[model samples]
Target: MTPEAPPTTPTQAVEIVRSRYAQPKLPDGTPAELKVHEFDIGYLVFAVFPPRTDAAGRPQPSPPGGAKIVVSKETGETVTVPNYPTEKAIALYRKNVERNA
Candidate 1:
């Protein structure tokens, strides 16, 4: 298959994230999925968590220490940032972009 071009839209950015990261897994080996936690025209942020209740039927909070994936809308580049506030993550992305530019 041919390589995908850099994402120019939000939907394309999402697809890139999904394809780039493998499915998330819980400590017990249960599989989880990445969900879009926040998005803007310039970046998309994804969080790793189980989509439904765990095997024991208890609600699962997202695991800590899972870095959030940020997809750049302008370049299709990706960066993993600490699982902190959304605003802070965006700021870090901007800083990285500037530093590289």
Candidate 2:
């Protein structure tokens, strides 16, 4: 198998951006929420996921491995919560957020 070429032009970059931002809605017709907002971490776009719930009706932390983005619907605030898959990545993301804020 051969590798694909990198994006070469501004148009290609825009297309790539659009594709990355595209997401499918859930079965209940609730669209995948992606809210852009101002935070302590400069500007960041948040992709809101279905809230993970417990049997006791509590909101649980998001699953591991996948990226976690936190947001407040009422306040319109957002933050890209670090996905601590690896120690290095976790530290790097945290540091970047801290430095930006």
Q: Which candidate comes out best when scored by lDDT?
A: 1
Q: What Cα-based lDDT does every candidate model obtain?
A: 0.66, 0.44
Q: TM per model?
A: 0.64, 0.35
lDDT of 1 by residue, 1-101 (tens): 12356676656766787777776677578765455544553554564554556889988675458677777655577778887788887788778878978
C-alpha RMSD for every candidate: 4.7, 11.0
- Kindly provide the TM-score of model 2 when superposed on the true structure, using C-alpha atoms: 0.35
Off by over 4 Å in 1: 1-3, 26-33, 37-41, 48-63
Indicate the TM-score of model 1: 0.64
Q: List the pairs of residues colliding in candidate 1.
A: none
lDDT of 2: 0.44
Candidate 1 has an lDDT of 0.66
Segments of candidate 2 deviating more than 4 angstroms: 1-17, 21-29, 38-43, 68-101
